[model samples]
Target: MSVVVKTSAIKTVRAVTFACLAFAVAFAAAPASAQDMELKIIAPAAPGGGWDQTARSIQQVLIAEKLARNAQVINIPGAGGTVGLAQFVTGAKGDGHQLMVNGFVMMGAILRNKSPVSLSQITPIARITEETQIMVVPANSPIKNAKDLAEAVKKDVAKVTFAGGSAGGVDHIMAALFVGAVGADASKVNYVAFSGGGESLAAILGGKVTAGISGVSEYEGQIKAGKLRAIGVTSPKRLPGVDVPTFKEQGIDLVLTNWRSVFAPPGLNDAQKKALGDVVAKMVKTNGWKEVLKAKGWDDAYLAGDDFAKFLTAEQARVTAVMKTVGLVK
Candidate 1:
C-alpha cells in the first residue's frame, strides 16, 4: 500500500510540472502586455525652465487628447542633466512607459560629464521644435548692436566677458562660434557659466557680465520688461516683431538653434517603440500643443521618429566636426 501511495504522489508532481511548462509557453507567445502604462515625462532641469515647461506641455496635451490615462512630469535636475539622465538609464531602462524630454544640452553634458550613456545610446523618439539663439545684454549696457559688441570684443578679447547657462552648452558653443568668426581667438575670450539661464541672466543684469549668450525664450520676459536688450539673433533671418538683427547682416555669420526632442531607453521592442512614436506624432497635431509652440516662439518643426533619428545623427556629426575644430572634442 505504501509503495502505491509513493507512485501516486510522483505522478501528481509530474502532471503539475507539465501544466506549468505549458502556461509558460503560452505566456511567452502572447501579445505585448501593457494593460496600463505610466508615462513619465522627465524634465532634465529644475522647475519652470524650458525643459520643465516642455515636459508639462506634453503632459497636458497627452492627457487632454486622451491619448493616455495619465502622464506625470517629473523634474530630475543635476550634472547639467547627467543626474536625471543617469537615473533614467539606471531605473527605467527599456520600460516603454518612460520618456525623456531632452534638448541639445544633453550632448554638451555627455561630452563634459563623461556620462556612461550618451544621447546616441537612447532611442530618438522625435524632435518637437527648435528655437533660435539670441544675444542679450543688460538693459542699460553701452554696447548697443551686434557690431558694437563685436568691436569691443575685438579691441580686447577679455575687455567684455560673456556669460552662458552652461559651460560648453548651446549658448557657450554659440558664443565660441561667434567669436571665432570675427578673427578673434575664442579661447582667449572670458566666458562664464552659471547654473541655468536664470543665474546667467541675473549676472548680466547685475552688470557682472558684459553680454549673455542664451536662448531667446529664457530672457523673453526681461526683454518685455525693458530690462534686457537683445542685440542680435543667431539666425539667417530676423525673428518676427523682435526688431533684432541677424548676425549674418552684421557680416558675422553664426547660426545655432537648439531643438527639443523625446528619447527612450535602449533595447525597446518594435511594437513598444512604434507605440511611443505614434503617441508623439499624434500629440504634435493637437491644437493645444500647437498653441504651446506659438506661445513659446518655437518653430513648427516636426519630424517622425525614424526621420528624427536620422536628423539627430546628422546633427551629431555636424556638431562633432564643429567641436573638433574648437578643440572641444577629439
Candidate 2:
C-alpha cells in the first residue's frame, strides 16, 4: 500500500511540472501584439497644421483606447513634408510601431521640390480625414470678397502676395487656380510659402501678406472672431452648419478638399502591415476618433488596406494633372 501511494504522488508532481512548462513555452512563443507595443507617429509639418492636428488626435485616441502601450508624436517640419518623409523612409524601415501623417500637400511638394523620397517608398496604411480650403484676408483689409481679390490679382500679380503652406502645397495650388480662374497668370502668382498654418495665419492677421489660404478649420476661429475675413471657401456649396460662402457661388469656379492620411515605414512584412492596419482600423471605429472628427470639422474619409493604396495611386495622378494645369509643374 505504501509503494502504490508513493507512485501516485510522483505522477501528480510530474503532471503539474509539464503543465507549467507548456505554459511558459506558449507564452514565450507568442508575438507581442500592437497593444503591447509603443508607437511613434511623425507629423511631417510644423506644429498647428492639419498634419500635426491629425497626429495628435490619433495619439490621443490610441492612448485613450489602450490600443497602444504608449504613443507619441514627433514633428519634422520642412520642404512641404519632404524632410520628414525622407527621414521616416530611411530610419524606420520594417518598424510597425512607426507611422507618418501626410496628405495632398505632400503630393504637390514632392513634384515641385523634386523630393528624392516619394510616398511610394512608404507603406500605405489608411486615409483618415478631409477638409475644405478657405481663403481669407485680414478683417481690416480692403479685399471684401473673392471678386475683389481676383481683381487685385488681375491688376498686379506681383503686387498681391498670398501666404500659405509650403510651396506647391494645396494652398499654393489653390492660389494659382484662383488666379487662373480670374484671367491672371497662374505661373506669376506672388505666393509666399510658409512651413505651417500658424505662420501663414500670423502673416494674414498682421496684414503682412495680401491674403492667405489654408484648411477651413485652421482659420475658422479667427474668421468667427472678426480677426480674419473669409472671402471664399473651396466647396461646391456652403458647409452644412457653417455660413462660409462657396467659391462657385461667388463665381470664381474653384473646389478642392485637403485629405490627411497615415503611412507606415517601408519594408514591413505582411504580418507587420496587417498588425499596424488593424490598430488604425480599430482606432477609426472608436467614439473618441468620431469626437475628434466632430471637433475638428474633418470628414471621416477612412479607407484602409489595398483600397487606400489604390486611392493613393489615383490621387497622385489627379494632383499631378492639376498641378500641371495650374503651371505649378511641367
Candidate 3:
C-alpha cells in the first residue's frame, strides 16, 4: 500500500510540472509587448478650432523633433467638450501611454455638463502654450475698434450680437466678460452658439451675426487679409506683428487668455511619469515648438508636473466662480 501511494504522489508532481512548463511556453510565445505606444491627443472640439490646431501643432512638433516615434491626434469632440472628457475619464484612465490636449474649455465643459471627470482625474503633464481671445466683426461692418464696439453695445444691446462656438466655451465666456466690462446685462445681451469656431466665424462674416469671439490664432489669417476687423484682443500685452489692441489698453479692464496643455491619464508610476515629462520638456525646448507658437499667436507659458497641477486647481475655481456669476451655475 505504501509503494502504491508513493507512485501516485510522483505522478501528481510530474503532471503539475508539465502544466507549468506549458503555461510558461505559451506566455513566451505570445506577441512581443508593443514597443510603440499610442499617445492620444484628444481635441475637445471639431477640426479647425484652437484645440484641434493645438493638437495638430503638437503632433507635428513631436514627430519633427522625434520626441514621439508613434503618436496620434484624435478628435473626441462633443457636448461642449464633455463627451470627449467622458472618454478621457472612463476609457483612458490610468493609461500613461495616452495624452490629451486641452485648455480652459475643459473646465467650462465639466461645469456645464456636470461631468464626473475633473482635473484631478488626470496627470497635468505640461502646459504647451497660451493664446489670446480676439473680438472680430464682419469685414463690411462699420465696427472697427474696441471703443466703437463697446459704445455700440452700450447704446443698444441688440445692435451687436455676439457669436461663440458653444454656450459655455472660451469664446462665449470671453463675450460674457466683455458684456460685464461694458456694464451690459449679460442675460439680455444677444449671444449665439455655433458648433465650432469655424462656424461662428462664418456666421459673423456672412452677416448672420454682428460680431464673433474666438482665439486670435483661429482668425489670424482673416485678420491679416483685412476680411475681418479685430476690435480687441484679450491678451494683457499686444501680440507681435498684429496691430490689434488689448482690451486692457482700451480701458476695458478685461484680459482672458486661453491656454493649451497636455494631460496624461492618472496613476502613472514614477519612472513612467518622468520619462513622459522628459519627452515633453525636450519637445518644448525645440525650435519647432517655438515656430509653431509664433505662427499660432500663442504666448509661451510652459508649466509641468506640480506647478501645472496647482494652476489647474486655481483655474477650476476661477471658472466656477465666473460661471456662477453669469448664472450658468448655482
Using lDDT as the measure, which candidate wins?
2
Ranking by TM-score: 1, 3, 2
lDDT tens digits, residue span 123-192, model 3: 7789878877889888889887888888888888876789987777777788777877888766556789
Candidate 2 all-Cα RMSD = 6.4
**What are the per-model numbers of colliding residue pairs?**
0, 0, 0
**For model 1, how does the per-residue alpha-carbon lDDT over 287-315 read when each residue is reduced to its tens digit?**
98999998888876778656777888787
- TM-score of each model, in listed order: 0.84, 0.80, 0.81
lDDT of each model, Cα atoms only? 0.81, 0.88, 0.79
Report the C-alpha displacement of residue 192, candidate 2, in angstroms: 2.3
Error of 2 at 54 (Å): 2.2
lDDT at position 142, candidate 3: 82
Q: Write candidate 2's Cα lDDT for 1-330 as tens digits.
A: 353458889899999999999999665433358679688999998888778989999999998998998989999998889999999999998777888999988999899888999999999989998899899999999999999998899999889999997677888888888888888888788889886577888888888999999888888889889899989999888998878789999888898889899999999877777878889999999999999999989988899877888988888997887678667788
Clashing pairs in 2: none
Worst 10 residues of 3 by lDDT: 28-37
